[model samples]
Target: MASEILAQLQAQKLLIVNPRRKNGLIIYKKYYAEFAGPGAIVGGQFDCDAIAVLPVGKISLIVPQTPEERRQAYKMRRQWVKLTKQITDNPIPAERAQVILNQFEHWFDAQTVENLPDEAFALLVGVLPQTITKVRNNGLF
Candidate 1:
């Protein structure tokens, strides 16, 4: 049987993510990836191209959002962007990859990134997935 990624839901409208309960990923332009970890929100700002669940643990769904919940979601997205800007802005590919792993390590095991295909990272930074492997393997892999 084909293995399906869990919770590949389309955002017909805004979809807010609650990271304490659900970890999610939003894919943009078919390649660039945004991870929604604890407190992050995906479709809140705009409709997402695609969103899928990360198997972090038993999952929970987003409830109807309150004002405070929306605020938290927006705040997390800002933090998420701030975190990855380091990767996207840097000219060095290997250095960009290393910075992303360093950021991920602060929240979760850097190895948990294996949950997503290496190609995602490749596309995100415009490098070969092999580059991600080479950089990731050097430490905390």
Candidate 2:
């Protein structure tokens, strides 16, 4: 019965929305993990350890994309990652943490910043989860 419902939705190109669902899958490689979000394509990763999805919060739209869309998404994602790397590449951990926090706070509202998972944010910023906790906490981490 559930399968029938899902099939119907999928056929209609409707993505399942888990209000508590995450926006991407984490492709865990040997040493680190990368994220595959909307418009991004993840494939040929047979040797990777595993692809773990986030606990549940953001919406991950896993679907096919046109070649043009894929190209655009790839460019945007690459740029975002590169910028994050630049920020995290800072020698001083304190400065790196502050920059990431400010960026997120600007991209998203303060509440959304608080809602983001600390571990994911830490991974993106090349910081430790504890650092994220300290930086993102006021109401909580």
Residue 1, candidate 1: alpha-carbon lDDT: 7
lDDT of 2 by residue, 74-107 (tens): 5645655576778868987656667877876765
Query: In model 2, which residue pairs have backbone atoms overlapping below 3 Å?
Result: 20-57, 21-57, 22-58
TM-score of each: 0.70, 0.60
**Lowest summed lDDT window (length 10), candidate 1:** 1-10
Error of 2 at 126 (Å): 2.1
Residue runs of model 2 more than 4 Å from their true location after superposition? 1-50, 55-62, 137-141
TM-score of 1: 0.70
Predicted candidate 2: what Cα RMSD to the true structure? Answer: 7.4
Q: For residues 75-126, what per-residue lDDT tens digits would candidate 1 score against the true structure?
A: 8877876767657788878887776656555555545665656666666566
